[model samples]
Target: MATTTHSAARSGGVRLHVQRFGTFLSNMVLPNIGAFIAWGLITALFIETGWITTIGKALGYTGGYGFVEDLGAWGSGSEGTGIVGPMITYLLPLLIGYTGGRMMYNDNLRGGVVGAIATMGAIAGASVPMFLGAMIMGPLGGWSMKKLDALWSHKIRPGFEMLVNNFSAGIWGGFLAVIGFVLAGPLVEAFSTLASKVVNTLVDNGLLPLTSIFIEPAKILFLNNAINQGILTPLGTTEAAQAGQSILFLLEANPGPGLGLLLAFALFGRGAAKASAPGAILIQFVGGIHEIYFPYVLAKPKLIAAVILGGMAGVATNVVFGSGLRSPASPGSIIAVWAASPPGALVGVTASVLVAAGVTFLVAAFLLKLDKSNDDGDLTAATAAMEANKGKKSSVAGTLVGSGAARGNGPIHSIVFACDAGMGSSAMGASVLRKKVHGAGFTDVTVVNKAISSLTDTYDLVVTHEDLTQRAEQRTGSARHVSVNNFMDSPRYDEIVELLQQTNGAAGANGAAAVDGAAVGIPGGRSSGGGDLLSRDSIVLDGRASGRDAAITEAGELLVAAGAVDGSYVPAMHERETSVSTYMGNLLAIPHGTNEAKPAIRRSAISFVRYPQGIDWNGKEVKFVIGVAGAGDDHLKLLGKIAEVFTDSAQVARLEAARTPADVQAVLGAMQPA
Candidate 1:
């Protein structure tokens, strides 16, 4: 096993899982951002204490239209129920509940119906708007109906299928409605009471600024939407209804910290990070794409301190002046912040943004000046880290710095669009490329789409969305990887067609290069037939480690002793962990060194250690640490097999239960060509 195989590194709750959860929370709010904006505008313009009151008096319409009483129903004596009250109380919650249910049941209408029903009950039970309650019960109702149907779906009589489906959903929805109504009050009281108490205590004690310690780090972990949409927004809405505005909305959505960090980089950074800084600033400050700046902090972990201090400064400024926005600033853009500011609060909000940015800039500038690390500060690697954290390639990051280097200069005749799910965007992208290829008179070229996890090293080129490009490359490393921002309409489509034409012409002149699509940049095509790479000696039953770095060191040390990689490669493994986590979900983390350390590999090999107690890997729990060493650019097949194994929860359970080196080896054997 000396000349043979393994992998390691990556997490907060497994980055993908956290990101998906964040996405789920944001999805419930993002699609309805317009409705929110409208509501906010109406409240600001038509409230009895709002702008319309002053404008109407000046226009002498104070006596004419009852717009004051009818619309600005903020207790104008006549007392007409306004649009604002009903929209927040009923429309918004129902919309969120329905969307949540639709998503849970794979976007089925039935799920939406049940979800809305459940949400109505929760709304009735709670005194405030039931946004959080809708979030909870909507998915619960959908999941319950899904489980209920599975029980008797197959047993239903042929003619009564539709009848059963309708009545079942109704009956289950009503049942859930009652349950929601009963639980909503307790759930709200429990969460709101605790949260409100903490916030109130912080505000009263003048310690509200302290929240940045947790808020800043959590935002970097891609939990901004969950913390904002799921927690703060609901609480903020309640506060705003009671007292004109709430500071809770400003806590996470303020763009000042990110702005300061980017400005510092633009002024005093090195290499690609410095160059990308100016470009990132536009979106970070104006467009409010806060994600654009995360990679910068991740590249320089010390930068977190700057953002935290800046965040504290801003919160303090806002607190001192009682400055707050009328509505949530969805994008965290400066423009949005000002637009949503209460009548006379502009000066306070302005001071907050400026003070935060100034403090952050000063601190970050000092850090950058004192820095001696980062060999030219590789922003590409940092962006790669961001992509992993986000579970997709950031369009802004890719545009700033992302290009695929082809391993060959030969003709291209085969292309594949691969993704984890194997369908959706991959299928559509493949169809687009197929049309362009055939239209350009290169019908000899074939384009197909499939799941990246099962791909063979047979394609000449692979086209994938920037986020998916990394996983796609792991499967087909030899393929020319083209990363595009959009599938339906990408400039890369035309460029790819043009590339094929040029390569085809060159191959026609040099016949040898045209023999087969795989002839150029093909792998050694080695397939493990069980026990070729992993063995009993390489397996640790009850692995010991102090933490993530320690577990990685242990795995790498095992590979070193097995003669798979040079001792120097172990340090490189540590370096890899600093840039990106290797956690691949299902409690498995494959730690491997950087490409620069590839020369240290003796041959492909794997070292497996099962830490039953689980190690903390960048805030993610890791039960299995598998170290990998791929020789001669050979990783796809071995890594793909491991990915496939960990994907199945049942298989993961079996591996978790395995107590012996032999038992672990038996499971690894299942990954062979069988």
Candidate 2:
């Protein structure tokens, strides 16, 4: 039945659509992350006021490290210029072109070569290295190559295909390269000049801190790469060349705001968040992986305000104290920030970071006032509800009708990991799931990562972050959708694993064998008329239990009385409850013993109990409690049946309204096996 919702899971609201566009922009820069880090390292070590220069000078006085001093001198002077200039002029363009080409068509060399050619042309025509030219020309060149290939592949003679291919590529490459040199050169220069002017104006006018209002929010939305590599780095490069340092380096590279938010969550948050926040703080602050803090803020979106305030505080502090970085910090780590801080500006940098953290901590603490006393059950329930209500999230087995088009049916052949930028978190997530899938022995299932625009109806399942759920669904026509609030810690993977197992099992059997839904009697036998596993003794018209735990115990007692399982199963069920709520949605929950308690089952049976007043199955209201006891995989059929029942809201309403044990028996009898 999947999970029933109070409202349909809809996608493609104006905000989500805007996010999709932003995500596309981010992806253009994301594939070149390794290159950015390399550039950052070079900029940090070789610039005059950079870390290497300061360290080399200090060591030279202490130990006569003349070679180190000379190296720093060369790095800070002409040698550094020789290195950084060619990097932007030649290598960066080629790398970006190749990646952009591959993004359009996987395992194709032609697109990459074409893109590089175009970028080289752009560089030749430009006065500067033309970083933005590479971005535009690379994708343009690749897409052009793909279109040309499609046009020529079918029409050309088979024997002379290679000749045609080579000639066509050469022709296109030369033309585009020349075109880029002519048109892209002037266009890139104009853009770069305008961008630099705007940034310089802001810094000159003392409005540099106000940039955080945009930077902080964009970072949370996974646009850090776009803002950093695509925009700030170019401007920073020009400024660093002139003044030996640039405040632009600190714009997206500041980790203070993220650290502050994590600290607040660590101190004042509840459940998994509180426990996870400390580790996140270490990763974000010390390790300088700012991506760690992104999910934390995403979990509670209001926390973005705190990060913005903190960023503003840090930027303002940098401005007041005249603290600037010789280069951009790669990971935005505190240590990296310190290393890049100008001479005698370490104190100012430290003060800025501290103030930012303190301000963010206070704001985040006020925003995220979590209750420490909440139990695991409540926490799980609250989290589930959040996922359920998340925009356009649905399983293939069910349709969540709302504003979006109804999704296609699926046996789930292909799984896609989608995000704002396909290369970042989505790629990592795909690898994680791919490993899990291989471990589970589903070697045939294809797992891929892609940007939202790249998604297609051919995919069976789409896993995406909560913030991008609607946009993902909007693109994933009829594909089963699942969203994770914390991409790092998605328990839903366990469910997907189970589904895969079932899928494999069905494939092996080569038959759509039926699993029982509402069994009433002993294994391989039914009661005279059909009300078998669920007898009157097992059926409770009015549950005597006041709470979810008590109701589960009541159901367990009935199961034991029916000889389906023994006394040990009760505690086993309780323990399972602690790990994950058994709530399956549609006012229904299927509570059962742990996997270790499989031996406790004497025979397969179900004890159906109605809790009219409703016991809190975590935070969800569970009216129907089906306590199941089965020896092996025998219980799956019954679970499937229950899912089917839950899918039909009318059927669930009928079952929920059933008054007597006889009426409940009738409801169970109505579920015929498939």
What C-alpha lDDT do the candidate models reach, one value each?
Answer: 0.74, 0.66
Give the top-scoring candidate (TM-score): 1
lDDT of 1 by residue, 293-390 (tens): 99888888889999999999999999999988777888889988887776657789889999999999999999999986652445667777876676
Stretches > 4 Å off in candidate 2: 1-18, 47-52, 59-81, 223-226, 241-243, 287-302, 326-330, 335-348, 366-674
List TM-scores for all candidates, in order.
Answer: 0.64, 0.54
Give candidate 2's TM-score.
0.54
Candidate 1: residue 89 Cα off by (Å) = 1.0
Distance (Å) between predicted and true CA of 512, model 2?
16
Give each prediction's root-mean-square deviation over alpha carbons: 16.8, 21.8
lDDT (tens digit, per residue) of candidate 2 on 1-674:
33333222233244355555555544555666566556545655654555666776777744543443343342246433335445655776678766666445332567788888888898889776566787788778878887676553433432454577788888998899999999998899888778778977887898989999999877765556667876776667556545656788888888889888888877887766677677767777888877666656656667788999999999889888877776567668998888666665777888889989989999998887753353234434433343333323323111111224333343567888885434334544565565455446565667777667577666878888665677777666467778764333357766776777765453333123422222222233353323345566787867766666667777888888887888887777664554335565567766777666767877777788887888776677778788877553334344444544555677778887887777765654566643
Look at candidate 1 and tell me the lDDT of residue 255.
91
